[model samples]
Target: MSVQEHRRLRELASMHFQSRCLHEACERGLFSELERSPGSAEELARRLHLHPQACRMLLDALTALALLQEREGLYSNAPIASRYLIEGTATDQGEMIAMYRRSMERWEKLAEALHCGHTPAPPSEPDPRFIHAMHCTASVHAPLVVEAVPRNNARRLLDLGGGPGTYSIRFLLTWPEAEARMLDLEPVVSIAQEYAEIAGVNERFEAVAGDYLESELGDGYDLVLLSNILHCNAPEGCQRLLKRAFACLRPGGRVVIHEFLRDGSLWPAVFALHMLLSTPGGDTYSESTLKGWLHEAGFGEPVVSRLEGTPSSVLVAARS
Candidate 1:
């Protein structure tokens, strides 16, 4: 390899070292402790019950990564960390990091999965942290999607696979007359209930606990949202879901599919790899493929648009 190529390859190969440091810090509540108050290495170690030497090393590494700031032997959360990494904040991503940590073990077996043609066995019960992580992610991007949706006299919505019902709550808040039914797994639906109650939309929001792939979806909905759901299945599964959504919506009602499009974006490519590692046949889809699926599912020509301020794009089609 050329000199520059060798250097680039080395940096890429060692990227996991940096990720491990960040994930470990988040797992250990380092950011939360710093958010409460700045402290020296020994002080933080004592508070979080870590060995002094290891804690000091982690603190220094976090500082180097710009997630923390250090001054005069004291460490504190950086502005970004304070806003998004500290637990209990409005935009806290602690749960998301925790979910990543939980997935790390499965991700480490990617090579084995490729050889065996399947992922490892799933846990018996759903992990609550994963649901919270989806909530955190949806809370940040739901508003962007809501703006893109057209809600003219739309009174009912079906949030298919709505993990935490963040989008449904936002939709309800945007259109006061609208009511929503969130369909998801039982464990995830329970979390959605809490979120709806907290948003004060429980009176208008209902949770349906079942698999979207196998459950019966009620009819006569003005809007059906398939946000972030398609990438969880293969193409045939996506077609089945689109057909189901088509069957459930009222005539002239719109079905919105929110997903990361394969349009040469770096993030989508990286997320596709993540799906490969974690799911049986999930991967990001192209816009042409989604449009074709919608057409096959009995929807009219779909309009594809990118959501502002988010990585996702939307395809809105109306049932004839």
Candidate 2:
């Protein structure tokens, strides 16, 4: 390799430095505190209860990364950070950043997974912030996705493994007469229920706290949504889940899958690595692979769509 190419390899390896720095900034609420008031590093350290020297270094690093701005030694949120890193704002994604931080430990196990097929150890306790972090990520795209899916004048819907139930809430809003049943882990289902109540659609939403794959999901649904869940299973498991989805729908009912298609993109390709680190045999699949699974599960020809502003795509098909 040329001298410059060798240097680039080291740079690529060290890219995790920037990710760790950003994760720490989010964990410390740096952007939100800075948004409240621009302050010198010393003032920020005191207000945020950080070690003085370390805080100064972190603030300067964030400034270098353009997530924060430093003017005359007073640090404040950069515009991008102001818009998406502040807590409680409409587009605040600080929680999502935290979610990435939480995954750092799992990511570290990639070498083990590669050599020994090791899965990262699960968290000792369920994370309460995870569902909220997912909400932050989903809220932006839910409206677009829900609007794109034809409501089909149907009344019953099932959201399998629907985290935070943002899609279900949006579905209910789009189809005013529709009722939704969202199944997920107990804690996650509770958050979904809370979100549905907040959306004023709880009257039409039911929360089922159980395993999406094994739960006795009642039949006769007009729609079944498998959003972001397929990638957690191996092909065989996904086939089973798809068959389950097929059986739950009424005749002529539709099933919609929302996921990142491994379509020669850098994002889903890297995300597949994360799945390897975390799941037993999970990985993102291509669109053709997904269509084959749908067909094998007894669905008709599928229609594929990539959400205009997001990394996710949808596959829609109906039980014949």
Candidate 3:
């Protein structure tokens, strides 16, 4: 192989080594401990009940990855790691990392899924860790999505597939008079309720538990949000859901869809692979394709807006 091609192949081959190193570090609470206080590998190993050599190697790998900093023999979390990876922080992403770690097993079977032409079935009971991970993610994205949505006289909202109802809570916060109904899987609804209560909007928010495709989403909503929901469904399923959203809205009401558009971004493209491994037909869709689906679902002309501070964008369509 050419030198350049050989180097690229080597990089790809060793990608999993870094992934495992980070995953193992997060799994072992290394970041959290380091956030509390810097320590030598020996001390950390004693505290965490790990071998000193293994702990040192892991800490050195994290330092190389820029997630941690080592001074002499003491290690501490880097600023980025302290902000996001450390548990109990306001912006903690530890749950999301754990969720990714949990999914690694399913992702390992990608070749088998390709050969069998089907992804594995979802667990009957939803994993609470996954729900918490989604909650953490939604908390970060809710403000961007709320900002992208057009402010109007929207008093009622239906948050379809709302994981922890973060978007709904944000919207309610933006419009004090607004009330929201969040529809999602049964297990997720409880999480949503907890978040809504924490946000002090539980009285204004209602949690409805059931599959959006099979559930009865009540009618006459001024707005409907399909945030990050389409990527979990096939194109046809997304179209059907849009139609349902259309039927649920009041006349001239709007439906807002938040998703990672296939707009030549590396993140969305890589996220598409995550969908391939996790869902049967779920994948990121192009903006033009989603617009076409919205049109076919009887919505009027759609306006697309890129969200600030995220790789996602929103498409707004009105029921005419």
Compose the digit string of candidate 2's lDDT tens values, residues 187-286.
Answer: 7878898989989999999988888778899899999999888998889989999999999999999999999999998889999998888777789999
Q: Model 1 — TM-score against the truth?
A: 0.94
Q: Which ten residues in a row have the lowest lDDT in candidate 1?
A: 117-126
TM-score of each: 0.94, 0.93, 0.94
- TM for candidate 2 is 0.93
What are the per-residue Cα lDDT tens digits for candidate 3 across 1-320?
Answer: 89999999998989878988888988888899988889999999999999999999989999999999999998998999988988777688888888887888888887987798667776667677887888788888888888887788899999998887889999998889999999987888888899899899999999998888878888999999999889988888899999999999999999999999998898789888788888768899999999899989899998888877688998999999
TM-score-superior candidate, 1 or 2: 1
lDDT of 1 by residue, 1-320 (tens): 89999999998999878888989988888898888899999999999999999999999989999999999999999999989988787788988877877777877877887797767656646678888999888998888888888887999999998988999999999999999999988788888999999999999999988888889998999999999999988898899999999999999999999999998988788788788777768899999999889989999998888987678998889999
Total backbone collisions, model 2? 0
On a 0 to 100 scale, what is the lDDT of residue 281 in model 2?
Answer: 78
True-vs-predicted CA distance for residue 96, candidate 2, Å: 1.4
Overall lDDT per candidate, in order of appearance = 0.89, 0.89, 0.89
List all candidate RMSDs to the true structure: 1.8, 2.1, 1.8
Error of 2 at 136 (Å): 1.6
- Give the distance in Å from residue 298's predicted Cα in candidate 1 to where it truly belongs: 1.3
